[model samples]
Target chain A: MRRHILTYLLFAVVTFVTWSQDTTAVSTGRHITPVRPSTNVVKQPGRDVSPELIEQYISGDTLAAERKAREDSIRRSYPRYPMMTSLWLGVNFIDPILMAMGQDYASVDVHATLNMWNRVQPTVEVGMGWGKTTPEGMNFTYRAKPSPYVKLGANYNFLFKSTPDHQAFVGLRAGFSTFKYDVDAHYSNSYWQEQTDFTLRGEGSHAWWGEVVAGLKVKIARQWSLGWTARWHHLFSCKDSEHSQAWYIPGYGPRGRALAFTVSAYYTLPLSLDRWPRKDSNYSAIR
Target chain B: MPLAWFYGSGTTKQVTVGNVTVYAIGAPGDTVLVNNQSVNELSLPLRVSTDRTQWCLTFMTTDSLFVTDTLTLAYRPIEYFASVECGAMYVFDLQQVTSTHNVIDSVLVTQPHVTNVEQVNLRIYVPTAQQ
Candidate 1:
């Protein structure tokens, strides 16, 4: 009888011990059910984790830092400049030279351009023009009064990423003028041996045109640059052409053609944007 | 071009005029366009400076009689743009035409619109008995 009682007592103690262990696990928020071991499935971590995963995380962070450092070094290779780079005031000399040589048409123009981030240049040009021509192999003698014209345009430099000392650029322009002109044309009849002359005049006339320009601007001296641009133009609308075309189109050179050229000398005027620290690179003291 | 067709017994046909002479009157030397030629068709040019044109036509008949007629034409000159290469030219719209009836019977205004393209713009008919 005593042996049976001892066996019952031991069973009661074992039952109580199992019940307390399950209750402790429940309070601690641990799973009572066994979890399947899988490499893909993620479980709530305990205090201990494999060292392999910890090593992977440390190496990954180091690799990210190294990649960022390499990228930053490569980026510093080019220039780092701000917007509103500089301003240029220029005067064209080609037309005046042509006029002095007794050419038919001439123009005198002064231009201003604002350089932005060494990439874009917004420009404006104002000028006066005149012409007189007894064109070779033609019957007409053409003449034009001194007229004023204006051109507005923008340029894109191909070498914007490089130094601003030399630039290669292509631009587009919209030009306008108000001008007056006259033409005297004589024709002789072969059959009657009679010559007749027609006198034509155009006044209060306005003309608008477009131009595609390409040029090279090179630094010739400190704060001075010499630039040459070739302009191919198309006359969009001209009130003078309906009566008689203006022989000279002020900023546009001669009428009835599509091409002209300009060689200009420029003086740089640095603005507040140019006050940035430029000593970091070989920038040639452009400001 | 003004097409002058001969009509005999109500049939329109080509009949060559004999000893044809045509000249522009107002020009400096009376520019002779066709100097005594036998022709079935002729093309005439107009003056650019004025709206009126005068032509003197002299032709011989079958009976060997020379008949002289004066053709007066008035038009509205239009300044026409031809092409970029050829520039501009003057074209005309025939408004009124009058002719002296010597051997010519009547003048019909066929097509009044004038262009550089070659087409008949006037019809000159000689008398049926003369034809």
Candidate 2:
């Protein structure tokens, strides 16, 4: 009976061991999910940029770039000084005519000019001039008086951002006058000197004159400015004659005179912009 | 821009332009014409004058295109007479011409029933003797 029982136990043990080994083999045999060599991590959306970057775009960097571009362009252009369309007023020298015969008197001129370097300026000037005819002992009257002249011209300046002081300039004048000749001038009740004095009876003739001028221009202040000008003029053809015999005229004998001269000065003024207008590069008002 | 030479005062003389001399001869206040063209029709003032030694005259143009007349008379004591005998005489004097606002090179003279006369030479008229 004992031997039969031992055999039963052994059989049971063997059956159990076989079953366990079968389960282990099944477990190692198959894998349902396939293995991949790389990780599958996802990237998150950007949400943490620094505030300074945003502020720089809004405040200065873009503006600075635009400014730099403009500066470079200006540096590449040619420099130019534009004409100033202004009225000028300043002091000047004048040469006067003393003879009706057109000879004998070449007068010294001293006067002031106004509206010198400003736009739409009005000016008035007074001057003392003296001229002489040859052969001084004749019985003709000769002298220069304080004469006033009106002049109109154009003034300009250059304001190339690339240059210094914005060069200033003015030019080409058209002038009108009541300039006249003194036929017979007497001094201190003395008989007029022949070379200095003369005989002609007529009122001064109205004349039209023209000139070309150039000058340096500068701004003294934000609202004030200054200029130094040089000008040349032609005292065109005028008509006159020697009156009576022994008129005692010298240099010209008995011919009409033509006078021409130059004027130079420094223009100064108080600063005021009450009526001045802001204008474009070409002097036209900006719309 | 042109360079202009202007003679201000002197005796008026007839001058030619492009080689042509024109003249109109008549008593004072007589209407004259060149090629049947009336001179007064253009309305430029003509003037006459006399100096101690010669006669001076000039013609003026209106509007810078015409001429001015400044005539100088010879200072002959005989010319001072109120009336004179009838005759024609010619006298010449040194003449200088000028312009105010235009180029003056030639002169034009209009005669009664005659074609317009033009001259380039400077000439002045003075009778040898007053009648």
Candidate 3:
């Protein structure tokens, strides 16, 4: 009977020890929350609160106020100014270099523009062109004397929100020219087996065209800039002689539709300084 | 004058008749028969070639016995802007025209220049009585 009691006691002891080891292993595998003592107490019914929640609410409000203050300071720094106007004079450099090639055409153009609020520029260009060409395979000689032409246009600067010292623009122009041309050629009919020499002279021939232009300008000095523009020209109308066509137009370039490129240098002159925004003025904006 | 000012220098050549059946001849398949392309009701718009100075147009009648005629035109293509919307086009100045006297009695150059102005430029006189 004593042996039986001892066996039963040993079985109970082994079962209790194994259960304690399993409980210890499960507790160690899980994340344990440390008990911290609460310093603040909430007086709400059936609710308990700590000091960390109140401190977090206070910090969130403080951060929002700081963000608002920073935005207000940025707004105060950049302010809008009143509309201002300036004048610019520019000369195209590509025509002179093209004239040296002796390909029967040359042009020199000078432009004047009014820059308004550094956004829109209204402009007018005047130029003189002349050329003479005798094509190699053709039995014809064409000559055009120096004639004057004019173009009126407006350009909208895309970089108006940036610095005034740099500009990227797109523009439209309407050009007109009246000039004279002389053509000496021989007309031959193969079926008729006849050749006739003819000389045609055209005076006061007028040509008109429209252009879409894109350009960029960069400030090189305090009041000087360097610029380049590409233009796509569409010929609208041209008055020609009965047997002759105008080979070259003064400001309109070739007699047909063409793409033209020009490099220019510009000088800006301030006519009225009072109308311009002061550099140190608080209301002066970059645009 | 305002309409002319708006259309600019681009003009198109239109061929029409008061009371006549006109069919433009084209070669389909292996045979060179009348291709049955009709331009009688609505006038046909002709486009000039960019490289060639001449345009050949052949016409056939729609009667029981078809009579065919060929007209050749010599012109100079002038590049000009038709309108702000149309962009650009070639306007032709009629220099000379020759036609075969088959069913067509005579051909008249009513307008010497052709543009995009939508007007009848050539007048074809066909025989009033058909065989």
Candidate 4:
């Protein structure tokens, strides 16, 4: 009876051990749900992003600091200085060509300008102009001698932020000229049986005018440039003689409002190149 | 309309008078006798003849003593298309001008070429006493 009882106890222990192992397996299985095969799902490629780079992009303070650094670098490239002067010798090609066509006009000018900040250019121009016109079948012959004139003005470049080699600008000028003119008119009256010839002279007559100018300048080489300007001139006042009005006012062109055109080649003499700050790599992108 | 401008000598200002009469030389019946005429202000619309190359204008003064003066203008008729709406008009370029010495002492062609632009092309010099 004792052996039978021992056998029963060992069998019961074995059954209990099997039952506990099964329960443990079932509990572990209950934690995991069955995954079905999804035909409609798609997988996208993942980008490898570093934590440091992400932090830098999200931070506003980092962006502001970088922008300030770039601005400071650009400001250091173009330093402010005193007057930077440049002298230019120019000519009006149109006037001389028109003179050949019997329109009778010619002008030559010299210019000096102070370039400030590569933005504002204050200029002074001195020129001599002369013209004569005798209309066909007219008894009068009008003549104007070469006379010197002066203009003071400033030009504002629209492309100030770009390279200094090229400029598109609009300018204003106040001009004055003192000139001499002569008019000879001859008339014959058949009915009166009389003939008369009269000569009128206007000496040392002064004229004042204003001009609105638009021009383009392109650099052909180092210290050399080609430019053309169109001007609309308005006469303010003109001194007239007793017998006749001044037919042409040297720099002013005609007696009234006139349009003038000029094409010029410039030889720039940079007066203070070493004194002014040089352009740096930042503006090299525009060049 | 085709028009031409005339002015008195010495100035471009309009000269006002009490009475004046204008007549075409060949067509004596066609006359415009204006009372209180403004000489410089008048924009004369010239009549061109197909048969003749010259136009004659006679001016009569209605003062205490009636005085007359004649002006002859020789021109070349130019036919050009001014615009679509304007169709065509005759533009005259004065070749020669002659005036009778009476009230008008002399005449000068300041601008021989005339266009639609309003300008003083002829400067008529009247006698000092008449002026």
Please state the error at residue A175 of candidate 2 in Å: 0.8
Candidate 2, chain A: TM-score?
A: 0.38
Give the per-residue lDDT digits (tens) of candidate 2, residues A29-115: 976887674777665422332354345445779776556545544533432222233333444432222245464443232333333
TM-scores of all models? Answer: 0.65, 0.33, 0.51, 0.52
lDDT of 2: 0.34
Per-residue CA lDDT of model 3 for A1-287, tens digit only, reads 99999999999999999999999998889788787669456654212223444454457875755565555445445433235556889998788787787656888899998877778999999999888777666666677889999999999988765556788999999999989877666544332233556565554589889999999999999999999999999999998654445678988776654998889999987655665556665532344
Question: Which regions of candidate 1 deviate over 4 angstroms?
Answer: A1-75, A136-138, A190-198, A202-204, A240-243, A273-277, A281-287, B1-19, B26-29, B38-51, B59-69, B75-131
DockQ in order: 0.17, 0.03, 0.03, 0.04
Clashes of 4: 0
Alpha carbon lDDT of residue A160, candidate 4? 70
lDDT of 4 at B110: 74
Q: Give the C-alpha miss distance for residue B95 in model 1, angstroms.
A: 5.5
Ranked candidates, highest lDDT first: 1, 3, 4, 2
What would the DockQ be for model 1? 0.17
On DockQ, who's better, 2 or 4?
Answer: 4
In CAPRI terms, model 2 is classed as incorrect
Ranking by TM-score: 1, 4, 3, 2
> Each candidate: what lDDT?
0.75, 0.34, 0.65, 0.64
